[model samples]
Target: MPDDLREGRIVIVGASLAGLRAAETLREEGFTGSLTVIGDEPHPPYDRPPLSKQVLLGRMAADSAALPMRRDPDAEWRLGVRATGLDPVGKQVLLADGESVTYDRLLIATGTRARPWPNADEAALDGVFTLRTRDDAGRLTKRLAAGPRRVLVIGGGFTGSEIASACRERGIEVTLAERGPGPLVGALGGTLSMLAAGLQRAHGVDLRCGVTVTALRGNGRFTGADLSDGSRIDADVCVVAMGAVRNTEWLAEAGLAAGPRGVACDAGCRAFNMYGIVTDDVFVAGDAARFPHPLFEYQMLSLEHWGNAVTQAEVAAHNMVSPEPARRPHLAVPVFWSSQFGLNIKSVGVPTFSDQVVIAQGSLDERRLVAVYGYRGRITAAVTVDMAKWLEYYQGLIETAAPFPPGPGAADGRPLVAAFPVPSNVPDPKGLFHGPTVALTGHLPDRRLTVVRPAD
Candidate 1:
């Protein structure tokens, strides 16, 4: 290993889960470098998953969701200060407060922010909200406690759906509008999405599919919303759960392969320059990184899962201090879970990346089953509704690239063979109102390699 990799200045550009985990792993791996963590938020790293679930439901406090540190990394913390720019050649990160930090190695894990409502004026209304940070969750929690007459959620993604579920749990009338045919269509595809729609509707959610919120009606406070179908909804609160926008604007002129999607990187976590050249000193991880995965035919995957952040950060930290021969690839199978409408939905691998899906265990009619996804006869992904126990088994099949339409014996005691597979019906990325939690951005497994940029 190089001496500089062991003892040198290291700066992490995000103080969130990925950055914190990377710093801890670096110290654990014997990297005695001068470490610094930069964050835009005023508080230390906190758990975001609960912000939409327990926090909004009043089961947990927003401020109490701080992530407990495994060990002190003994690094300088720059909280509430944003990194304004990056000078890759100069090896310095320019901050918002006219400060710069030089580093021998840099970890870019700035992550993403909630995409704001398109109209700035309408978004500023009293009841308009978007949940991403602790402050956002705290404000929304207070608002929900006040018992608004009706809550209108603009997008039917996971966050939006969860918000609606919370509203329903509070006995508040909630209307969810989705531009697609059903909820979760962008991530789980059309088949499972149908089940999601049914669940939402069955649970007292006024689920409106194939409709867009054309305008928000308000007078200092939100009153209602105009829909595309020439109908107006009277709601006192509105949540724009459109999705997230990658935090890569600061690196726009840095010449890195960064854009709206995310910063491009190799499977080894090395960031790529604008010319597509890999740089050794700089690495990327978490939701802000798009890296290729060999298991998915080397397609560059952009993941926003909590597990991905921890595993990828560890891999990046290991590679940052280890020699090329000892560096390992970040090949962890993508996994995600959601709780809504009294159903525990979990998925392994990229469900949208598959072309066909089969019900492996339980029946969809029962609303408690595992749906296995495949592409060209290869098991690619699996999704379960209240059937999380088999997630690990399906994950192994995906990791091994097991044959799709898996054997009949894999099911429970029931002798159920692989059912006839149906089209997954994944939507086009451009048409999606919300970003997918797991996105396969590179070429298809059967297709040749191609460079896919955010613009393309």
Candidate 2:
């Protein structure tokens, strides 16, 4: 490693999980230069997964979810300040407070924010809320504890489902409205989502599928919501859990390949310029980065999973300090998990990228099973319900690109023939309000380019 690479100024844009981890890695890699981390929120880096689970359940406080740092990076912390824009040409980050910070190497770990309800006026209603940050969780937590008559949850995504579960556990009446066929269908596909829908209803959730909240009714405070199916829900509180939007708007004019989806980057975490050329100094990681992976046929993937963010941030930090020959690619497979309705659901690989699926083990009737997904006769992904112990076994199959309809005894040595394969039944992403945890950004053979061109 060259001394020049180790002693340059480095700036990280987001002070969340990925940004914190990347800063720690840069120090561990022996980069002794000046480091700066900027964040719009006033608080330090914190864990977010618990905001919807433990915090909402009253087991943990929102402020107590702070992420423990492995080792102090001894970097400048610019909290409560927003980065208005990026001057890639000038190698500076423009701040909202009429200031610019310069850096030799830049890391955009801005991540994502909760997608709020579209209508501004209705969203302003007192009881309408969207959970994303610690403040949001704190506010919602107090409301849930007040014991509303009925809580209205719009969208059937993981966050919404978890919120619904929390409401039920508190003995509060709640209604869930999903535009899709069932909850979690957009991510886990039709088979397992059916199981999710059943769980919600059995637990006393007013599960309404194939419906959208047409309008939110309120008079200074949330009164209820009108559904697309011509039905109205009268509740004191309404939570909009549609999905998340990547925080790439600040980089819009930076000449990077950034848009509503996210910033485009190479597998090595190098950011691409507007002209599709990779920039050596600018890099991306966390939910804001969309990078290609050879395991998924070189498709650009934008993952919102915690594991991906941690691993990718480390790779980005390492490559940022190492020579070209020593740099490594971020190829960690996507993984995500959620707990709702007394069930622990875990997934490995991109479940939405497959065409067919089969019950490799257990049975859905028992509410415990491993569903394997395949694309073009090769294993692509797998989801386990209360059977997470065997997740690594299926991950190996996916990594090997094992044949579909995995033979009996593929994972377990016991003689149990796998069930016949069936269509994974992944729905069109356009119809759902919730975004999948792992999103395949289409087939981009030449990831260097912004758009795929026809072969001559």
Candidate 3:
């Protein structure tokens, strides 16, 4: 190992969960380098998951969700200043404040921001909001506390569903609209999404599926919304949960493979140049990185899971300091969890990457079950609804590439039978209205490709 690798200037953009963890990991790996973390936000890194759940419900203060530092990296922080551009060849990051920071190694953990509503005028309405930052949560918390007559949520993804759930928990009337068949259909399959729709409606949520909010009809403040189905919803508040946009616009001319999908990277978390060539100095992690996963047929996965941020950051940090022979791949299976409508939905692996799903344990009618997803007869992912105890078992199955429909006598003590398998309902990326928390990007492996070719 070269001593220089562990003792050089390492600049990390996007002082976020991934960035913070990477800084800590670098220090833990004996990297005595000069570390600098730049964040556009004025506040320190905070936990975003709670912003939609506990914080919005008033169970926890929005500002109190600040992420606890495991150990100080002893690095300089450029808070409230955005990274304007990247000079890869020059090894420098241009800041919005007209300053440039030079670095030997750069970590692009810029992450993603909430996608704003397309209509600028309507989005600027007084009661309209989007949840992504700490301040956004705090402002929405105040609005929720005011007890609006009704809350209209524009999208039915996880964030929208959670927001609707929080509104309902506050005993506030909430209407959720989804362009798809149901909530979470883009991530979990149609079968589970049907269950999700039922769950939301059962809990008094105005679940409006297969419809989109065509326009927000508001003057100075939010007054109502017009749906595609020719129905008008009268609500005082409107939340645009249309998903997130990766923070890669600043890297547009940086000669990196970055765009709407995210910055392309390798399994070791090394970033790729514009020509698809891997660069040694520049690396990326978190929701901003698209990396290939062998378990999912080597498809590039762009994940927004908290677990991925921490694990991938550590892997990136380790690889940045270690020699090539000792480098390890960031092959950890993706995991995501959401609490809405009194159900704890947790998924192991990429459910959207699979083609078929089967209810292995319990029943969907009972709302306590483990659904396993498979691709080519192999288990690829599992989603547990109020059955999280079996999450570890399913995770192991995914890690080992266990056969679909699984065998009997597993953790739950239920006979694993191949129930009717249904299409996973993974939507086309082009038509999607929201970005999924776990996205299987890039080309899927060709199942028919063989090593030997028949002579034509």
Candidate 4:
């Protein structure tokens, strides 16, 4: 490795969890380069998972969620400045403030933003909220603390489910609307989705599935909404938890394989140009990266999990400094967790990549079990509800490509559930309102494609 490569200028866009971690890793890896971290938010990088959990429950202040730095990266912090353009040929990042920062290597860590309500007029309503950034959490937290009559949460994803759980914990009236058959179906498949729906309803949540909000009713402030089923919800507050939009629009003309999905990259975290040629200088990590994994049939994965961001960032950073022969692949299995409705939910691998699921251990009726998901006949994913302790074991099985309907000794002589291998019931993303935590990219086997025939 050349000393010049080690001491060259490295710029990271998006001063987020991924960016901060990558910066720290670079310095730790003996890189004495001039580093610059850029962010659009005025505040420095902070933990976002808490925004939907402890911050909303009043267990912690929104402003107090700043991430603890492992060690100072000694980088130049360019806060509150948005990167408007990228010149790959010149290795320069154009800023919105008429400034351009040149870099020997660039890292794209621009994560995602909350998908707003479709209706701009209704979204501008005073009582409406979308939780993403610290400011968003603070504003929504204040609104939640005001003791509204009733709160309506649109979407049934993890964020929406957590918001509803918080409202219920506060003894507030809350209605949850999910356009899918049940909450979390798009992410965890049907077997667990049913359990999630039951959990929400049992906890006093006015759960409404298979329905969409047709209109948000308000003159100047959000008052209520009308559902597609011709039902009216008169609530004091409305929360749009529809999902997230990747921060890739700004890179449309950057000559990279960047789009609504994300920037396409290889397993080693090297970004691919629009022509599918991998670039050595440009890299991507966090929610903005769509990298291929060998386990899931080489399908590109877009993971929005915190663990992925940290691990992938470390890999990207290490590769940034290491020579070609010493570089490593970012092959860590996707993992995510959520605490809602008094239940700790954890998932491993890509559940949406599976076709069948089996109750390998515990019982759904007991609300404590591990659901193992399989594609064809091999283990692809596993989800545990209140059985997170066994997650590591399942993760090992997935890594080994263990056969579905895991054989004896899989659960330490504990009898597997009678409801063995069943359809995973993973639905189409377009049909669901909530965005999935781990999105399996490339051509999905379940999605229908119309064949256009030329005139004979």
Candidate 5:
């Protein structure tokens, strides 16, 4: 006999956007069980995309940007309480208050947080921060309000680039340092990042590419940073947008498969233990779950995008209360977007997985076009800047596993160029993951086999 959906104790950890969505879906699926949500944050889940843009630009209040609930979930909201530990044998979650909540079924959506500067003495410096939570935005926003003389932003990824864009929009002087060759090389590619460098320079940004911030110097508060190219900038503030670290440390002894990458999960969102054995009652989602994807040779992907969180959460919730026959798979294409350097960049598929890329539409000269990436002889990813209307077309190509290096016809008669530049992997600023941020790492595919989407 299958478990009854009407009455099983369900506990959700992390209280993030994904956690909230799962709670709502559980109730919608007619699960009337005792439900409780545990979180380290004091407030409800809020939208995070705006933190780098609107919040920094003084356009939106940190609290006001929170996502509105579709309906009252009615679950016991354990706000501000952090989960200290997890005991799979007892099926209980240990809270900071020394309270334990037992559950027949559990969902882990812990997600990730910005990885701060490694040195404690350096991280403790004033005006140095990382953006992840609403509270983080609030503090940074207030600091930006003070109108610091100069801002030194480290890392040139989406978050860091967006912060620079906000500064430029505010007429604030900023110096951006990237360990990679250019701004978005870690995510997009060095080829496209060249254009990004151009955008920044056009807007009068002190964009320093292919250089690193070796050390942050300050007496007690942040005053300046030393660059790898033998240069120094005396700035009043510094923001470390060096990427994120998965928040799965508490699950170490929980007997689950958690590691530096993220928790390993199957297509149906069922969590795997340290030995790779799938669990029946435990599930995982969001940036903390590394599930395999067909587009990237089925290697597990750990994504920090907003769409992945919502989509993966729904899949986990549905599978939680449904029979095996009724369970669905999470096969959503990995996509992400960012607004920086006065350009709206949207990407579908994993660009870092490709060995070659071509400007399929618009024109690189104009800085408005879609670039298609290919691995071996198949389409792997697509990136668009300003010209986003054509992304849907290329997205269809990826969804259908279309041919590699999509023809100039993909341009839809925009214009033809002789050739375009392909990109190479550029590691993070901290030199943690030497691979590209959107890495193409995976098992070598059998050349004889064609790419196929996995079954649910």
Candidate 6:
């Protein structure tokens, strides 16, 4: 077996944001190794957040969303090539072009893809699009700029909401259909998400709550959408802003503990086998990894957030080159942001992990406040809208396992509630936009841990 990964070839899958950052981190850690980064997309590593925002709003071109290199790793880049299989025994990755990449260590950073609309025939319509890749954004942004009669945005999630915001900013009429009671009900719960619903409707969006898109009707181009509420919308353009789907299908036969959530990994980013045994050389990172976080009840979480992609990649890269004793675990708090309809929403922590929410600062009606999420008398997450300054204080509470609703000095000298009950029926995004592919399985994580060394 290879003694260490200081010199031998190291291959990385998913040459997107996380993949490029990991390569840079590998070099920064003083590892002079042969690195090969593979991506299914032709473009080099690019920033995805901007694709949904600036690119879609026509402020920036999608092709120009390439992320500035954090550090010069100078690794071999394999773009536009699909990874077909992984041969763990041979330490080789099978490429779709019938080529094999042998490696001493492997990093899986394949993040996720945009969940497309169901009903393949309907999805293939001209104006129907899903935003995920840079190319997808380029196409959608240009299409949105064409000034369609009415835009139909399916799903009230962040992506869909952002797209609707962009369309409204363009002065185009938009119809947002959500099966849930309110916008962002899946992530921010019913109480806060109701504010989002009001915000969208006030901005001239035909916000239809408690209705799902039944079908898309168009010959070759999108004409309109059929709703589950026995109503039809005349939509010339439709944007499916469903969440994400983890790109882990290529590892089906690798005998790794991978499922719909993602490849199971330890806090140290070490990939586990199908039998729940950890491997020494195979590591997982980015959105494709479902690892345990101490802050979230020690439950294995699969996050597709942008901050987690860079944080976890650096941790995986460092652990890949360092000795076991010198290695570290990735316990970074999950943080994410989305700008939509003139509101800047930021979240620190897993909002879904909480059972209750409270208004910590400002009022929801003012559209400038923070909601603290709690579960079982403990703070689990916090969401702020245009009030990000107070988020840091709440983030500290979450990290130290602070109590729910917070104590005195938690906010700006305001009274704190101890048992703030989050509205119990925060609709599941899967239930709202059932067609989007992003799914975080609601299963008790398999936390069975095992330590192993290379065979003699």
Q: Higher lDDT: candidate 4 or 6?
A: 4
The alpha-carbon lDDT assigned to residue 89 of candidate 5 equals 90
Clashes of each: 0, 0, 0, 0, 0, 1
| Candidate 6 residue runs with Cα over 4 Å from true position | 416-424, 434-456
lDDT of 1 by residue, 164-199 (tens): 999999999999998888889999998889999888
- Scored against the true structure, residue 209 in model 5 reaches a CA lDDT of 74
Of candidate 1, the 10-residue stretch with the lowest lDDT total is: 447-456
| Cα lDDT tens digits for candidate 3, 311-417 | 99999999988879899889898999999988899999988888888888888888998999988888889999999988998898887777776766655666754
C-alpha lDDT (0 to 100) for residue 449 of candidate 6: 45
By summed lDDT, which 10 consecutive residues of candidate 4 come out lowest? 446-455
Compute the lDDT for candidate 2. 0.91
**Candidate 2 segments exceeding 4 Å error:** 1-3, 414-418, 447-456
Model 5 poorest 10 in a row by lDDT: 426-435
The CA-based lDDT of model 3 is what?
0.88
Error of 1 at 337 (Å): 0.8
Evaluated at residue 56, the lDDT of candidate 1 is 89
Q: Each prediction's Cα lDDT score?
A: 0.89, 0.91, 0.88, 0.91, 0.82, 0.84
Per-model TM-score versus the true fold: 0.96, 0.96, 0.95, 0.96, 0.94, 0.94
Question: Native-vs-model 4 lDDT?
Answer: 0.91
Query: Model 2: per-residue lDDT, tens digit, 278-304?
Result: 999999999999999877888889988
Worst lDDT window (10 residues) for model 3?
Answer: 447-456
lDDT of 5: 0.82
lDDT of 6 by residue, 1-456 (tens): 457657778899999878998999999998797999999999898888888788878898999978889788979999999999999999999999999999999999988888778789999999998888888898988888888999998888888888889889889999999887777887777787788889998999999988888899999988998999899999899888767777889999999998778998889999999988889989999889988776665678888788899999999999999989999989898888889988899999888777778887777768988888888777878889999887788888887777776765578777653335555355555576623222335433543343322112
Question: Taking the tens digit of each residue's C-alpha lDDT, what string does model 4 give over 43-159?
Answer: 999999999999999999999988989999999999999999999988899999999999999999999999999989999999999989999999999998999999999999999
RMSD (Cα, Å) for all candidates, in order, is 3.9, 3.4, 3.5, 5.5, 3.0, 4.4
Q: Distance from true position, residue 19, model 4, in Å?
A: 0.3
